[model samples]
Target: MDFKLSEEQQMLQDTAARLVRDAYGFEQRESYRRTKLGYGADFWAQLGELGLTGVPLPEAYGGFGGSGVDSMLVMTELGRGLCLEPYLQSVVYAGGLLAQLGDDAQKDRLLPAVASAQLQLAVAFEEPQSHYHLNDVQTRAEAVNGGWRLSGRKVAVIGGHSAGLVLVSARVSGGERDEDGIGLFLVDPQQAGVRRRVYPTVDGFKGCELFLDGAFVDAGSVLGEPGKAFAALRYQQGRAIAAQCAEAVGAMEATCDLTLDYLKTRKQFGVAIGSFQVLQHRMVDMRSELDQATSMAMLAACAADQPDSDERSRTLAAAKFIVTRAGRYIAEQSIQLHGGIGLTDEYAGSHYAKHLVMISHQFGDDDHHLQAYSRLMEVC
Candidate 1:
């Protein structure tokens, strides 16, 4: 129940905030958006070198051996900076899964590269029809030639185009959405029949649609037990969503601060707009929502690392749903309060707004999470 941040956590937050302000500012983000990578390679390298990428990883894997809270803190700062780098993809999605389920051999081979930023990863789970359920995957991984032949289409795969490896979720037995018989496998992007078409998302990040036709993976490539992969993947996804919720909270915080600062200086009727009661009320409302989102983010992060599966699902869903709804409202209010200039690209509001929009939809939207919450509540 203690809510205070430790000194180390405070230092990490300060460091991240400073780094974003000094290096990952608006102009830098704009410049990097046009690059083929759609992000700063050097900045990512620096983060890796600084051990930020390995903060939540195990010490045995060349990481800092920190807990999930550490990763949440870092991602929160990344969001505050409006960072375009795919830190979530490499760390939360790929690394979390690998650490939790991959064997020691897999860890020895992949964790070092990930820790050093020498290799990047992306998770391929979504399908054209499979919706947001982690176990709703329809991609098939049929046994073939002493291995598996994967053939399916995954859409909206973040960072897939540039990933050195892709951890894919496929259905072993051909059928519609079901939790049973699902499998997770590591696939090399250079393999034949694995195609990635990269595209830009609204938040200035790269997402790709993967077409795997007869893509082969050795038996050793499976990350975990075939029929039991869903729980592990879902756990990793909850953690990933928790990180994103924290990130959204960060963006909302920045949005509120930016709006408040603008109100203080912006003149209307020959006076500071902030002095107006109506404007002050709007700012107060934004701050309230931001605070709620932050609280929910912390709850979700804690729940994500919990040992109880049922509790983790419920807490995560509730937290995600609450944060998504509140964060969206705050971002929209920020843009509206900023007036016509807010919608323009030059203004920082637009960037934060776009990121908020993307975050709201990622992993699960408000509606998705709400349904999950309902289902969990009914079961419990």
Candidate 2:
């Protein structure tokens, strides 16, 4: 298969890269991290103005209607800059879910704002006990007076603290672990009975624990049929995983570049450390891992926009597994090559390492995807 980017894709990639290069310097990133929203609001608005926020959404709703490859190009640039915006959460994951599962009225109302970045969204599917199992929903949703009441807790809701709306998954019927009973609801964060406890994440980002105490929502807030949203949730999560793999590839590439540069400039034994044969071999290994990660990321991006199928699921799981492992290796190796300086927060390499390591934990980690891939193999 051909791998070269189309002219349009290259232009999108360059646009994202240029924006990141000009605006996301390390000190600037740190300042953004210190903001109330934990990212640069102006930078996010710039993304909207430039149409980057709409890259993967439907065109009918103020989007570009681009494919998953388009999203991959943008995400790679964001990862290279260690950007802390909620593009993955608000645009790719929540936006795709809305496009797939929302009714005509819901789509017409919400997607345009999301595409324009006028409204930020967060997803609350993970429970403390779910452990990455999309079907293991325990939060309860009950019908009441032509509406619904949700009561449960959602943990690690990334970007939840600042989101205007949060897409929450709850069980409306069947057993807690049953796949047939899950429902997705669009909830206003400021509504009665909703509470959020925000905190900083290990990788310098922020997230929140969402508490819903009988939060009420009208019928219009439900996405698709109640208790029928599990499939869509899983499918959109696969798309997010694909984008995440691409981001990891970008972080890995940045880490490799930093290590190689350090070796060339840092002196050891009256010469550049890069002149040593041992370190040179390690650098070669890091590059090999990056190359492998790049291939898997490309495979994931190609498959992410395709119709849902067993093949697509299997490919995504495999891609995520490979990329997670490669990212971990690259992160560790980059830090080691940089020695003590790499661990300092002031250095870009350290931040890249942290971001690379954290990428594994999102969606699912290496071991989780490995098991998922194994199960799919058995099904095949």
Candidate 3:
């Protein structure tokens, strides 16, 4: 496959990079993080104005209907900026799920708003005990006269605190860990019987814990069939993982750049440390890891848009595993090379290091994906 980006893709990447560079300086990012929303509302609006928010949605909803590679271009810029926006949750993951599984009416109502950034969405799929297993849903949904009544707790719902709508996974029939009987429900955060406790994540983003006690949603609020959303959930997660890998690659790139610059300037015994062979070798190793991660991210992005299959699943698992490991290694090496300054909050390299470390814990860690790849290999 050709690795060269098309003209349009290059332009898209440039646009995203410019926007991020201008609006997301390190000081500006810290100010945004202090806000109640945990990010700059204006920057999000800028994304919509630039049409970046709609890159992956359908054309009918005012989106560009771009592919996963298109998303990778935008996400890399966001990652390089260490942006705190919820593009991965709202646009790529939740929007993809809505487009894939929502009924016509649901799409007509939500997709356009989402594409325009007039509405933000969050997905709540993890429970306290699920441990990265998408099929392990304990939240229960009982069919009611006009809708479904849901009761359970969802943990670490990124962007859920501010989202207008949250898509929750609930078990409609089978056991907690069963693959079947899973349903995705659209929930209003402000409605009765729902409670949200918001907190700032270590990575400088905000997320919430959702407690549902008989939360009610009308029949129309369910996405796809009630007891059959596991496949779509898993598929969309694969796409998110691909985007996340791209983001990690971007962070790794930034970290590597910062470390290289530091090595060339920081002096030890009257000469630049970069002139030392040992330090030069370490910098070279960091660059090598970044290159490997970039290749795997490209593979993951390509696989994300393909038709779902064992091959797709296996590829994504491997890509995520490799990217996570590479990100951690880069983060540690950058910090070690930067010395005490690398751990300072005021330094951009330190923030990039934190972002890289946090990326590993997001969807699944290295071990989780490694086990998943192993399972797929056995099946193959």
Query: What is candidate 2's lDDT per residue for 1-380, written digit by digit as tens?
Result: 99899999999999999999999998999999988889999999999999999999999999999988999999999999999999999999999999999999999999999999999999999999998999988899999998999999999898998999999999999998999989999999899989999999888889999999999999999999999999999999999999999888878888898899999999978999999999999999999999998999999999998898989999999999999999999899888889999999889999888888888899988899899889988988
What is the per-residue lDDT of model 1 for residues 92-191, given as tens digits with 9 covering 90 to 100? Answer: 8899899988998999999988987888899998888777877787788888888999998999899998999999999896456678788999999889
Q: Give the per-residue Cα lDDT of candidate 1 at 198.
A: 88
Q: Candidate 2, clashing residue pairs?
A: none
TM-scores vs. true structure, each candidate:
0.97, 0.99, 0.99
Best by lDDT: 3
In candidate 3, what are the lDDT values of residues 192-251, reduced to their tens digit?
999999999887899999999999999999999999999999999999999999999989
Structure candidate 3, residue pairs in collision: none
Local distance difference test, candidate 2: 0.93
Clash count list over all predictions: 0, 0, 0
Window of ten residues with lowest summed lDDT in model 2:
246-255
Question: In model 1, where do residues sit more than 4 Å from their true spots?
Answer: none
